[model samples]
Target chain A: MGEFDLIARYFTRPPRPGGPTLLGVGDDCALVQPSPGHALAISSDMLVEGRHFLSTVAPDRLGHKALAVNLSDLAACGATPLAFTLALALPRADPQWLEPFSRGLLALADAHGCELIGGDTTQGPLNLCITVFGEVPLQQGRSLALLRSGARVGDDLYVSGHLGDARLALEVFRGQLSVPAAVFDAARARMETPTPRVALGQALRGVATAAADISDGLVGDLGHILRRSGVGACIEAEAALSVIAARDALDAEQALGFVLAGGDDYELVFTAPPDARAAVQAASAHSQTPVTRIGRIEADAGWRLVDAQGRALQRQDQAFDHFK
Target chain B: MGEFDLIARYFTRPPRPGGPTLLGVGDDCALVQPSPGHALAISSDMLVEGRHFLSTVAPDRLGHKALAVNLSDLAACGATPLAFTLALALPRADPQWLEPFSRGLLALADAHGCELIGGDTTQGPLNLCITVFGEVPLQQGRSLALLRSGARVGDDLYVSGHLGDARLALEVFRGQLSVPAAVFDAARARMETPTPRVALGQALRGVATAAADISDGLVGDLGHILRRSGVGACIEAEAALSVIAARDALDAEQALGFVLAGGDDYELVFTAPPDARAAVQAASAHSQTPVTRIGRIEADAGWRLVDAQGRALQRQDQAFDHFK
Candidate 1:
């Protein structure tokens, strides 16, 4: 089928009557209505073949990860999914590839009540670009928006879910490491379909001072929150290492490196007032997503990792730099 | 600079207080507050190196056209520009290229009051994916949104601005034709930096029954409107030829082919009631964009081109298809 025909047959769907979407695909533009008194949260992300994923990766998994990464951005801002547009450039019109990709993409979208509103398909190297729109309700006499610059000194730093599994999967894929078959499967799933903490993020509204989604490793991503908030952090090495799913699978040194600097973890790293610890725990319980306090926001100007004995640990790895 | 630093230096901007944008760059997601009681119009377009434009094209013009094509989609829906996100992939971080690109992009955005909200910058083959957000106000108790399916039998079909110049420029670039230096320059400008016709579209809101932007040529794009509206049209060949800026430079048949089936025009082709002709004219006058009555919508299900004496014109070229 041609580009337009392919979209019409697979991606286009009738807009749900009385839904936020007034118009969907098959037009010059898609129309949506933002809920009254709510601000729309928008983010865009692009994934290129080789750079973002392997050619042998399942199309469905690739599709899921593509949208999930963008949704993770919204999650960091405490917004609920609304709709998204996918601009896909494919080498050819292969139904085998297209079907599974759309299935994986829409399945996740359906789970979050996010609809595929509109997009464009073209001929090029395999590249997926998604722009997701979300709704953030106004609360507490201000928009209940979590920002990178909102973290304060003395705030307790927390992270959602286990870290390092996705990176472990990458190491396996790169043939640099080997793991038990079951462990590899679990880690691969984490890499392919890392869940966006949307529910937990919404629950943290009015609770967390600042938040960010971990994509480029915990330390590097957290550094964004620190740089923006003008705060420092002292991460408890043991606490951080405990959150790695493969903590017991690797040596202490290797575990520490992956826990702190391994990337592709879509968990939430946030901070809240020390007094709101119970409230933060309640949010975690409500969302059913595990949370652990790993560090403290500080007035000092740089971040460091400290061992259980309170000695600073040597840093070895840097964040993934796309341009580098 | 790295990807993040490149974004911060070139595209990031401070949010305007009390503007529609609640939060701009530097956040996980940009937050925008759509005007109350209006529907958001969103569209995405991607431009890839070698496929969409020549590498020799000016970076500034390339940037303007990238966003302009998306804005043209909004214009087709009669929506006012609001904000846009740019996801750009480049081979390397070259400040010389980025400065002009962002300058051109932001200048057009600033012209239409659209803000650069948020996006991603990565290292890869040069590609630009832009998702633009627009607002369409409700009118006459309905959303006042224009749709391709809204055309009716006997409606007067109109086109905004001149046509075929962009195609002519492409021909020259491909070494298929030559023109006077002045004509080449004008046509190249049209090809590289075609205006989106935003004002004209907003003005035709209540007057036009349906609208679409001419991107892939007059016949092919209007075919989309016809297919969706379940209507047909007989375009006047003489009138179509008249709109080609390079008409005098080519044979009648060649000019007709370019005017009817050439791509990259970026003009608006809309249908309106016969009684709304004056209103359409007024809209054109108000927007300072020319409008030409080129045909009439019909109940039949196929399109045709007729000469001034009412003889059917022979079809020559097909619309530009990316894959084919």
Candidate 2:
């Protein structure tokens, strides 16, 4: 199929009745209603083959992960998914790929009540870019969207959802590590179909002082929170190590490394006042997402990894830098 | 530099005071305030190496054209530019390319008063995907955003700015055509930085019945309007042939093919009732954009190319289709 035909066949749909989309696909631009008393939270992510995903990945999984990564950004900001535009460039139009990809993409979008509004499709190298629009409710005089700058000294730091499995999956894929079939299957699933903590983000809006999605490893992503908030942190390595879902399949060092510096974890690392502990727990419970307190915000300006005995182990401010 | 450092050095800026952005760039998602009573017009365009643009084009021009294409969509919808998010994938973080690219991009953004809110930068094949947000005024419960479906029978079809030069430039680049030094330079400039008619689009808000940006040639992009509006059109061959800016550089047949089927014009094709000719002319004059009335919407169902004597010539619905 041609460019327009591909878009029409796989992406275009009638806008839902009374939906936020006043004008959708087939127009030069799509018109979407911005919710009153709310700010629009926007984020864009582009996934490229061999860099963002492996060539062996199923198209359906690639589609799911593409939207999932962008949704993770909205979840980090406590925004409700509203709509998204996809700009896709393919080497060629293949029905086998488009059919499953659209099905997987639309299924997740439907589950979140997020509409696929409009986008551009063309023939080029395989690249999928999604720009997501979400609504972040604004309170009387302030935006309630959780920000990395909201963390304060003495605030408790917590992480939601299991970590390290996605990285473990990568290690396995690279033939760097060997694991049982069950463990490999679970890790692969975590890598391919991460669950964005959207509900948990909304629940923690007023509860968490600061939030950031952990895509670029705990150390690197949490450093963003620290740098923005002008605060430091010390995480008990044992606490982090305990949260690695695939810990049983690896050594202590592997677990610690993957949990601390492994990228591709779409969990939320957040901070909350000690007094809001109960609320944080309630939010975690309400969202059905598990949480573990790993550390506390400090007055200083760097991250320290401490052992169970309170001895400093490693100090790191590194993430997976594409250039480096 | 690493991803974050690259972003901070080139892309990050302080939010404009009292601007639409509440949060920008550093966060996982940027928060923007939407104009009350107005619908947000959104469009995305992606440029891939050797596809949307040539590898030999200067980085600065690439940046300008990248954002220009998206702004063209907003212009077609009569939306006022607000902000945009850019998602870029680069082969590497080279300061040489980035410096000029960011400079050109931000320069045009500043000219349009559009903020660079947030985006993603990654390591991959050179790809740039930009999502632009614009605002269309709401009037008496109706969006003033021009839509392709609004055209009616007896409406005069108008085209804004120049045409064919970009295609001529392409032909010269491919060694398929030869032209004088001045002609080649002029055509190259038109190909590289054809201005988006944003001011004219906004001025035609209630005046024009329908509008579309010409990206995929006049025949293809105009076909979009016709199909959406359920109308046909008849264009005088002499009129379209007259608007070719580089006509002096080529034969009549070459000029016709380039004007009718050349893509990447970045101009607007619009329609309005013949009685509103005065308003259309006033808008064109007010915006300082020259427009030529080349066709008229008809009761019939397909576009016809007719000669000066009203003799039907070519009945074409052809446009560049990458996959075809």
On lDDT, the leading prediction is: 2
Per-residue alpha-carbon lDDT of candidate 1 for residues A149-261, written as tens digits (9 for 90 to 100): 89999999999998988889899999999988888899899999999999999999999999999888888889899999999999999999889887777888888888788
Backbone clashes in model 1, listed as residue pairs: none
Q: Per-residue CA lDDT of candidate 2, range B166-208, in tens?
A: 9899989999999999999998998987788999999999999
Best by DockQ: 2
Model 1: DockQ score = 0.81
lDDT of 2 at A301: 94
The DockQ figures for the candidates are 0.81, 0.88
* Ten contiguous residues with the weakest lDDT in model 1 chain A: A138-147
Which runs in model 1 stand beyond 4 Å of their true positions? none
Every model's TM-score on chain B: 0.98, 0.98
TM-score of 1: 0.98
The residue-by-residue lDDT of candidate 1 on B151-182, one tens digit each, is 99999989999889998999999999999999
Q: Candidate 2's residue-wise lDDT over A82-142, tens digit each?
A: 9999999988999999999998898889888888999888888899999999999888847
- C-alpha lDDT (0 to 100) for residue B56 of candidate 1: 99
- The clash count for each model shown is 0, 0
